[model samples]
Target chain A: NAGVTQTPKFRILKIGQSMTLQCAQDMNHNYMYWYRQDPGMGLKLIYYSVGAGITDKGEVPNGYNVSRSTTEDFPLRLELAAPSQTSVYFCASSYSFAGQGSSYEQYFGPGTRLTVT
Target chain B: EDQVTQSPEALRLQEGESSSLNCSYTVSGLRGLFWYRQDPGKGPEFLFTLYSAGEEKEKERLKATLTKKESFLHITAPKPEDSATYLCAVLPYGGATNKLIFGTGTLLAVQP
Candidate 1:
């Protein structure tokens, strides 16, 4: 299994720019998530999808958006990006959607490092 | 509020030395506690998952034990390959919502 794959391993964006970080999984997972990690800090959730056609905001969802139109893809959209948005972004998925009652383990992707100037 | 904290911030051990890392957490409900290893510039690799207090899991030289309020990862006669940042995370009750709250992590360096 390819597990989780994220596109654009690295990117540099100017203030006010817009971009989308793509995340895909081949394990046929029903749960997918987006998280950001800053230097010397733990990860903060940005958004997540329970399954195709369902998305929800997480701890830190400001200035970002997400779409889960298909089961295999959960893309994060950054609109009018700022320096505060710069961080190492990770995409993760799990075999099952624990549905507000489960604690299934999640598998992660290598990540995408983005810098906003 | 649910929070996870890892102690010793960092540790340096000789190849034959034995040591344990700590993870203290506070959550209304714990679905599960997780352990992960992360190498520099790479994503975290899953290690073990502990579902209940008094539960334990082992892999190679690493052993993870869990309690209601904390968890411990004991490294026995660790090798240089064990040098990596160890992260602890929690799956809070009420969801497999794909969200895992993580600690800053403990950086362990095993010298040969």
Candidate 2:
């Protein structure tokens, strides 16, 4: 399995510009998440999906949107990007379900480094 | 508020030396605690997950032990390749949500 994969390892966007960070997983994970890592700030969840057509806001979801249309793909959209959005974004997936003991561990993609100027 | 904290922001150790990284947490209740190793410019790699207090798990050169208040990642015999930023996260016991709270991480550098 290729596990989780993300597109555009790096990108620089102008203020007010928009872009989509694509993420996919071959592990058939039912759960996927988007997180941003700022130096010394740890990982903050932006959004997550329990399954296709299901999504929820996380700790930090401002300026971001997400869609999970399939079990393998979860894309994050940044509308009107701001400098505050400059950070490394990670996409992760996990096979999880109630009563399943072996699905809590998450697998992560390499991540996308985004800088808004 | 639920939170995770890792100590010793950074450490330098000689190759073959042994050491431990600490992760202290404050949560209402914990479902599991996870340890991850992240190399510079790469994503985090999962190491171990402890489900309860008094639990211990080991890999080749790493052993993770968990207590009620904290978890420790003990490196038995460090190699240069073992150097990385180690992160800790906690999955709290609550609703169906599986969100995790993360720590800032402990950076380890093994010098030869």
Candidate 3:
């Protein structure tokens, strides 16, 4: 089903440059998220959306912005990139029904490797 | 604040050897604990989910057990194909979006 897909498998950027990492899911999930994994570090949450047109900040939201204009797309924007932004970025999605008592299992994309010099 | 920690940062085991990886967590109210397997240059693949103490789930050579403050992932008669970074994550009670807080992960290398 091509569960989840992310564009730009690898990228390199100069400091102060800007770009957007594209993510799309075909699972019809209501919840989508963006996370960054650094070497020897846990996956840190950056931003998430419960549904289209709804978004919120996560644990590590600084230097990143996100928008969910459609159910299938959630894009992460990096403005004025810095070295600290060099990391593997992952996009994940899940389906959750409120009050259903079911645990949500997140499905992740292959991830985008970004390097800022 | 919610936090998760995995032990033995890295482990190397010979073929057919057995071992366990540990995940310790601290949170106000625990909703669920999860296990995922990640290979090099790829995203994590979900393995198991434990809801409460005494809960256990098994898949092939891996079994996951949960407790009040920690979780254990046991690998039995492991093969080289089982080598990967094992990650644990927690979903706390009262979380609005149900986001998971993940650990640094345990990197396992099995030699054939």
Compare the candidates by DockQ and give the number of the best one.
2
The TM-score each candidate achieves on chain A is 0.93, 0.97, 0.97
| Per-residue lDDT over A28-56 for candidate 2, one digit per residue giving the tens place of the 0 to 100 score | 88999999999999999999999999999
- For candidate 2, give the docking quality class from DockQ: high
Which runs in model 2 stand beyond 4 Å of their true positions?
A: none
Ranking, lDDT, top scorer first: 3, 2, 1
Model 1's chain B TM-score?
0.97
Question: Clashes in model 1: which pairs?
Answer: A100-B94, A100-B95
DockQ values per model: 0.77, 0.89, 0.87
Write one digit per residue (lDDT tens) for candidate 3, span B20-89.
9999999999989999999999999999999999999999999999999999999999999999999999
* Global lDDT of each candidate: 0.91, 0.95, 0.96
TM-score of each: 0.95, 0.98, 0.97
Scored by lDDT, model 3 comes in at 0.96
Candidate 2 global CA lDDT score: 0.95
Q: What is the lDDT of residue A3 in candidate 3?
A: 92
Q: Top lDDT: which candidate number?
A: 3
User: Compared with the true structure, what per-residue lDDT tens digits does model 1 show for residues B1-112?
Assistant: 8899999899999999999999999999988899999998889899999999999999999999999899999999999999999999998877546468899999999999
Tens-digit lDDT track of model 1 for A25-103: 9988888999998877898888988889999999999999999999999999999989999899999988664245444
How do the candidates rank by DockQ, highest first? 2, 3, 1
